[model samples]
Target: MTDLASLLPGRFGHLVRQLGAFGGVGVIGLLVDMAVVWLCLRGAGLNPYAARAVSFLVAATTTWVLNRAFTFRGARPEAAHRQWAKFLAANAVGGAVNYGVYAALVSGVGFFAAVPEAAVAVGSLAGLGFNFTASRTLVFRGA
Candidate 1:
């Protein structure tokens, strides 16, 4: 099968590949977020808002690890702790956007309140562009 990068023109191919990889990582992150939220809400007896906050942190950490290992593997190296911190700090805007969407959906919509994972998915997508841009430019420059 032809590679995805080859299907695109010039540097756009590389960007497309990066976006694909980032999207894959984002899927994993969404799963992690959903699972964590479910566990927090059900097992830990937390409110939806509180569960979402906990889940977001967990999911962010998960994505940072995966993005470092796979999505932006070609990026220049730094201390692990430092890079992780930078990743978190750099993606804060995206995280806020993600959380705001989730909070609004869960608070305003009965379906989302009952099915928080669905809200998580929506929030994840809402922040996808911002997260990818921040990851590529600020957290993982040159990748």
Candidate 2:
């Protein structure tokens, strides 16, 4: 089967390629996040919110490395520590947006009230645009 990005043409091509790379990396990060949350809740017997906090950190770190290496390559190189900090700062707004959406979906919608994970997925997507913009413009502007 043809790759999904192959469907895009013209000015959107570069963005589509970047977005595809980011998305692939994001999937890996999501797996890490979910696994950490599961392990913290099940193995460590942590509260759900506490588990989520830890999982978010793990996922953010993973995504930062991957995004710097692949998705935002060609950008001016900064120190690893500095870049990581910038990544964290840039993503904070996105994180808040994600959480707000998730909270609203789970608490305000009857359908999502019964299936919270679906709300999580929707919330995750809600921040994608802002995250991409911040990563490209504020965090990795040299590219």
Candidate 3:
């Protein structure tokens, strides 16, 4: 397969590569988010809203670990716990946007209420750009 970065303009190749890596990590996080939400709802008998909150935290943590290891490996090194905290804080804005869209869909749409994972997918896409930018500039700033 042709490298995605090679298809982009030279000036943007590095950024496109990073975005591709981030997007790959995000896809894993989305799967994690959907699974957690489904399990919480089906196994634990939690409400959709509560399940989503739990799932978001789990997914965010998963993405943070993966992004640190793969997406932004050159990120400034810091204490692991401290970096994790920073990652959470920086992503909160994107998370709120993500959650807001999810909440609206689940509360207002019957289909989304019945299939919350679908809502989760939509919400994740909504927040993708914001999350990528915040993560890159705020949480993972380095060479």
Candidate 4:
């Protein structure tokens, strides 16, 4: 009881550090995704959903590269092709989570009716946990 509670805090503290690092990676990835989305949709006249997919692809690639170099750098290299394939698969799931949140906020909440800021806010909050957990376990697993 008491011992379990003490261990819980220690375990949680370690998780907090990992989550923080994971979030730092996510922040950079989000910026990349948003920038590409803006350029493709606003500048190139692509549909919003299509733009989001392309942007997510680009951002996912960037996230993998960065996470390899930073978050999971200590892991012994798996086979190159296998590792990349797994990373891409993980990103596919994360992208689904991300796009779902964006769509829900923008459409379900009528974020388009209220303001762009509301959409961004709601989507970010909704997708944060999915992105963090997926990237941690699937993308950056310790070897």
Best by the TM-score measure: 2
lDDT of 4 by residue, 85-104 (tens): 77778667666676677777
Candidate 1 local lDDT, 21-119, one digit each (tens): 899988898899999999999899999999988998899899999999988998987888888888888678887898899999999999999999999
Q: Candidate 1: lDDT of 63?
A: 93
Error of 3 at 114 (Å): 19
lDDT digits (tens) for residues 1-143 of candidate 3: 89979988974898999898999998898899999999999999999999999998899899999999988899888888887888888778887888899999999999999999999989988788888988898888882
lDDT for each of the candidates?
0.90, 0.88, 0.89, 0.72
TM-score of each: 0.76, 0.77, 0.75, 0.63
* Per-residue lDDT of 84 in model 2: 88
Give the higher-lDDT candidate: 1 or 4. Answer: 1
- In model 2, which regions exceed 4 Å deviation? 1-11, 102-122
List runs of model 4 lying over 4 Å from the truth: 1-14, 95-126
lDDT, candidate 1, equals 0.90
**Model 2: what TM-score?**
0.77
Each prediction's RMSD to truth: 4.7, 3.0, 4.6, 6.0
Lowest summed lDDT window (length 10), candidate 2:
3-12
Model 3 TM-score (2 dp): 0.75
- The predicted structure with the larger TM-score, 1 or 4, is 1
lDDT of 4 at 114: 72
Task: Report the lDDT tens digits of candidate 2 across residue range 35-107.
Answer: 9999999999999999999998899999999999898888897888988888888788998889899999999
